[model samples]
Target chain A: MAVWLRSLRYAAILLAFTTSAYAESDPIGYVKTHAGAAFVDAGGETLEAFPGLALREGDVIRTGDDGRLGLTLLDNTVMSVGPNAELVVEEYLFRPGEGELGLGVRLLRGTMQFISGVIAKLRPEAVKVRTTTGTIGVRGTRFLVKVED
Target chain B: MAQRSGMHGGNLLLAALVAGLAVSACAPKSWVVLLPNEDGSTGRIIVSGPEGQAEVAEAGTAASLDTAVPETFDVSRGEIDTTFGDALQAQPSPPAVFRLYFELGGTQLTPESAALLQDVLNEVGARPGADLSIVGHTDTAGAAADNEALGLERAHFVRDRIIAAGLKLDRISTESHGEGNLLVPTADDVSEPRNRRVEIVVR
Candidate 1:
């Protein structure tokens, strides 16, 4: 009986841990500019995207055929995602002087505009954008990338 | 004469300066790592291209990646123009800007601007963590100094309202352009209603 009770308690704790991780993650970016039918997916919940709405890691942003979004990360990198685009903030870290700096994004489909910010300026290798085909590394400046489905 | 000796000393100083500059110029170029801040982003771009990987930084600098058989490359900012122009142009938009007009020499807002307050406040509240630049302006009326002071007062008044509307104080900055930058440029001390205003540019 004790063994069974302990296993049940373990399962309860695991459930609680997963629930909090998905629900209360800190935001990593925000919707600076958006139009049309853009939406943000926090874990599994999808909500319409609006300007100034907070974004977080593992969060996926999808824009309808009539939608577009401009997101500025905490590190100041500006990304403009085009219509019918899906972008994911896979990982981001922006503590400059302390050397904790990274920005990893996945452009799942459609097009993405990248303007490298402080994270890549401080350390070039720390910032990387991945598409199904290959990766985009920033030395600095702005660039555009499109992914074919 | 003392004049001749002074000229000799000056020539020696000039030579030393030239030597110093030459020595510094011959020194090997070094990479600069920019720290993150409120204004600009870093200048590094690295891409894995077919002819090995390439990296560039800054607009007018030179960087050598490999020492063996070294070749310097222009450090112009990197940009790739794939076929995303049409896609981006379909939805190009700028950040929202709010303009508020004020009465001459007073912090009181005009009737039209008073109505705009709700929308301004709502916009600020909606854009959480956005940085704002609040600029105050005045008609060419009154002494230049007083107009500047009045403009400043008006800007401060607007700033306080935005902060009271739940915007972070640190994110908003107030500036008084005074009567110098009039919307309707006029003769000095002219009371132009169009010139008196405060602008809240939210970024």
Candidate 2:
């Protein structure tokens, strides 16, 4: 009876793992540069940001007092954030062959630098960056934004 | 009574001047600034707020985000460095793209592209935590479905070579555009060497 219960527990664990894997989406980007204390809040877990950390569509990237982070997306879009920053990737869809392209990000606080990528080049109106007070429409360019407390 | 009223008006003007001076002493707390591209061309951005919209088309120009109306101003270099030093320092290296051409109807790369493979490997080695996207395209010489398969085959051929060079397979994504996305547009059944190519984007 003891061996049978152990086997049943193993099966249950395997099933949970497979189900979670199936539900998760592919990473949209990766953190390429990091300094000090940065964190990524993804899928209800807070992960310490590292150079190779995979970033998902709904991830919220935050930086502490001395933290800084840089990331590059599949569409070649580059974004960087400075200390005390909270930025969320609200939406991202980059299926060019199927005529689907969109990139949206919201900056809740702190500073950021954005460089437009292939998606912005292909469809300029599809990319947007929102702040609490205003929205920015990208036109295949590089820009910097700061949201104070 | 008239003299006292005039003095009161004078005090109000004096207060207004002081407030104006205070406002000009420091930059707006929340703002955005446009920058020139690497190619030295300035692009445009439209900032829309609850009150109104403002367009910034010149490099070094800024717009206030929390203002009643979009207020445009010029940001000096010193101010930019002071405000965005950390964010600018954290900017990642831009992505690089390489085009490798293939021979007609096969996965074999042309002589020039074969020679260029070394550069691609070197690029992959230089960056830390690098990832790659390889997209294959085919000339319009066959059925769309067949071309799609051929494109995938060509992409796989390149991916295999990269993996053989010791890079992990998980970091690379391969896709095929078939003849649908042609570098050099042509009539159906027309063959173009440029269209029979693969684009490798290293990021």
Candidate 3:
């Protein structure tokens, strides 16, 4: 009886984990300008989300040529993703006067420079910038990111 | 006029009391970790919570960067190689080598580089008693001083991640060789991708 009960509890935990993973939102805005091929996991298969494709955090934004991409983050952080650039929003959360906000991104490919704002400054720990090689736990500051092939 | 002056004083006192109380109510639970720059500067102070994760609630409470974060370091001018040589000799082999590539004047590690880190981490985990030595190298780009610091930062970036991943703090050593050391030497005028890298080796 104890074994059965433990198994049930494990199943419930697994369900909760899978549910949270599905909660991520879709891209709200499209790519402003893409010099190279930009692919998106449209529905299931990877489809091209080129110029005019709406973009959001967590969207795989890539540049074929040495191009650039402009993304408007949830907190209105304007991120200019550079060519051969790959970036992802790992997590983003914002809370008002209580001063709690979380911004997390992973830079996979090229370069990205951030200008911190209310969200990033109010709760700097809420912001996390990750890379293939490492991660940057940042606050309200200006910094640049360059990822290579 | 005297009565008005007295009232103003009382109001000011009340305001001050309220502000003090508010600050106390919202003050963040704080902790500080000294993040040394790859360069030789005093380094950065990363204030966070129990897990070293930045607490947004305390972002305002924690101090801002008091001074410039060392963005660059040089091996030739800084005699940094000596520090690294000593560290390498004493350090254990890294479980794996995490390879990185960079763009010109850039400090970001690309996707392919990140994937490489995953493998490196696995290798580190597989081997017990292994320490990591993060050696950074820069291309013969701009000035020697700039490349030196850039290489150091890249090495630090790797070291910090390994620490964050719950590795033993004492198990890792880091060093940066700016533009002074290159895998593919250019003729004083070329930028090579081979040089811009942070290599993770088991000690």
Candidate 4:
């Protein structure tokens, strides 16, 4: 009887997994370099950010006054977020071979360093970074930005 | 007259707060910088603020987007901005490539490949903090989908062999080129021995 009940519970778990809401989000990047106190706010759960931690869309990276974080995306684009900053990753898609490419991020406030990857290099106008003031368009090179109140 | 003076003082305080916020808006720090990548490819950065917009085109350049008029400075010349100095030092060296061929439609390596691992071992031993990139390719004899899987399988085989040979690298990326990028160009559905191979790029 216990075995049968355990089998039923396993089937229920399988059903819940297969029928869960389909979300097309994967780890778009990883925290390649981390220092001091940085946190990832995902679904309102603030987890301590570390190197190699996978990052996804709808995630916000909040850095303490002494924290700094570096990331490398799938397209090899690298980013460095400075101290006392809040950076949000809205969307990311990079499939250069099939030509489906995009990169979108919002910097609420703080300092950021961006190095263009394959998507921005291939399609000169596909990447967009938005701050509270305005939107930035990439033209295939490196740049830095800081948002202040 | 005294009550009126108090009202005026309150208004003055509110105005001072607003002025303080505005002053902080454009207060420029030292700078934010983007250094050159090791791979020789360049990246451009665009800054759009309330007052104006500016873009930077060169590597080793910096922008302090203070007051919306983004100013570019040559940070790499004399005194580096202490914030980005570490990132500049972390730039990768140019990649060094090693190739190993495989037999047709299988993971089995040719007899010559036995000596090829020694070369990879030597390179890994020499470089202290090098990253490895393994890319597998296949001939055009099979379906494109199947060839993709086969290519990855072959690359994984090589990756595992490298790991087993005792190179404890933390970052190793594996990819499959399938029937693309032929060393010797061939027609459709052709079997080229050289195409069935894996290329290892140590950087």
Which candidate number maximizes DockQ?
2
lDDT by residue for model 1 (A4-83), tens: 99999999999888867876765676676677888999866798887667788888989898888877665567787777
> What is model 3's interface RMSD?
18.3
Full-model lDDT for every candidate: 0.66, 0.89, 0.52, 0.70
Q: Where does the lowest 10-residue lDDT sum fall in candidate 2 chain B?
A: B1-10
Count of clashing residue pairs in every prediction: 8, 0, 27, 5
Q: Candidate 4 residues B1-203, lDDT tens each?
A: 00112235556556556544544554466344554554566656676666776777677665664446666555432223334333333322234579999888999998898578788878766654445779899999979999999999998998898788675544577889899878889997999999999988764
Output the worst ten-in-a-row residue range by lDDT, candidate 4 chain A.
Answer: A18-27
What is candidate 2's DockQ? 0.79
Q: Which portions of model 4 miss their true places by more than 4 Å?
A: A1-24, B1-34, B39-43, B49-55, B59-80, B83-100, B110-135, B141-146, B159-177, B181-184, B189-194, B199-203
Report the error of model 4 at residue B44, Å: 3.7
Best by lDDT: 2
Model 1 C-alpha lDDT per residue in residues B17-69, reported as the tens digit of each score: 65445434432232211212123543554544223544545533332222222
**Candidate 2 Cα misplacement greater than 4 A, ranges:** A1-23, B1-26
Q: Which wins on lDDT, candidate 2 or candidate 4?
A: 2
Give the least accurate 10-residue stretch of model 1 chain A, judged by summed lDDT.
A140-149
Each candidate structure's TM-score, on Cα atoms with residue i matched to residue i, is: 0.49, 0.87, 0.35, 0.66
lDDT of 3 at B42: 30
Question: Candidate 3's residue-wise lDDT over B1-203, tens digit each?
Answer: 00112236556556556544554543322111122221323322232222233322221122211112212211120111111222112112212335778666767777788777777777766654445567788887688888778888888887787777777765466777787778887876468888888877652
Candidate 3 reaches a DockQ of: 0.03
| Tens-digit lDDT track of model 2 for A63-97 | 99999999999999999999999999999999886
